[model samples]
Target: MTGLFADDSEQIDRRTSRWIRDAVGERLQQCLRPESRLPTHLEQLMSELKKRDPEDDSH
Candidate 1:
């Protein structure tokens, strides 16, 4: 009975892990789509920063 429970538990854990991985992969695909763009405010801020210190390649 103990060994049976262990096997069942492992199977449940594997299914749960696979489900999480699939969900995260779907979310990542949505976030990384080519149509994704930075917000306008952030883009402006980055442009200003680059103009302020164009030589700052330390980042």
Candidate 2:
């Protein structure tokens, strides 16, 4: 109870916390590419899922 959780969490959360949340939101929009016409800027996002495991799919 006094390792990674007790230490580093706060520092990491403050520094790169936005990255995780942004990735989650961006990934969600990527999943909808097949059903909707995505904007040009989203081209990479639409294809991002290919990098993840097909069996581990999560929305």
Candidate 3:
């Protein structure tokens, strides 16, 4: 018989990913204070990156 969760590994992977992300983010933010600056070629690089990548609202 087919199980209720055809793929339990997927759920476990997602939960693990979220936990790792949250833990890393909290520690990194605490270690690094606010430091913001952009490169001179940022605009050109950004255009290229956008063309080559799909954006995600993670940060």
Candidate 4:
């Protein structure tokens, strides 16, 4: 059914997002030296992510 498919698709998308965010965050932590600016960078990234429209699809 369409409903079932949609539900699964949404779940997959959420999991994928979590995986990507976690992977990027882990790598950022490992590669970003000057620990002082890490928080600022992370805050900016999160703020931008929150501002972006999920349905826009225009990167």
Candidate 5:
């Protein structure tokens, strides 16, 4: 039989993901503005990501 904790963990995971997705959408909407600044923001993000791992091309 499955334990009660399994269902609770699954529910928690779903809730956490939904919250994160919504938060990201809201934050991105606020950050991505003026239309022209999109490229610069993207480049900055990419540069930061590359610094973490030089071979990370999946970004």
Candidate 6:
């Protein structure tokens, strides 16, 4: 029946969503650990951005 198929589809969607949430949570936890460091390129970019800019107001 269509109802049975819909129920199965909903269950599958829920399981998939839960799995994705768990995976992302684990990855975020890993990233939040003390040992994590910003990538070199991003660090360089941030350093450049921190330099004085005449047009910037938040100095």
Candidate whose lDDT is highest: 4
What are the RMSD figures for all models against the true structure? 15.5, 10.1, 10.4, 10.2, 10.1, 14.5
Please list the residue runs of candidate 2 whose C-alpha ends up more than 4 Å from where it truly belongs after superposition.
Answer: 1-11, 33-59
Model 1 earns a TM-score of: 0.36
Residue-level lDDT of model 3, residues 1-59, one tens digit each, is: 98888977756454565566558656756776668434558547645644543332453
Clashing pairs for model 5 are none
Best by TM-score: 4
Check candidate 3 and list the clashing pairs: none
- Over all chains combined, what TM-score does candidate 2 have? 0.33
Clashing pairs in 1: none
lDDT of 1 by residue, 3-40 (tens): 65665544545446546645864775688767876678
State the weakest 10-residue window (summed lDDT) of model 6: 50-59
Worst 10 residues of 3 by lDDT: 50-59
Over 4 Å off, model 4: 1-12, 39-42, 47-59
The reply for model 6, stretches above 4 Å from the true place, is: 1-12, 34-59
CA lDDT of each prediction against the hidden true structure: 0.60, 0.58, 0.57, 0.64, 0.59, 0.57
Give candidate 4's TM-score: 0.45
lDDT of 5 by residue, 24-53 (tens): 757877877756444677768746645655
How many clashes show up in model 2?
0
Candidate 4 worst ten-residue window by lDDT: 50-59
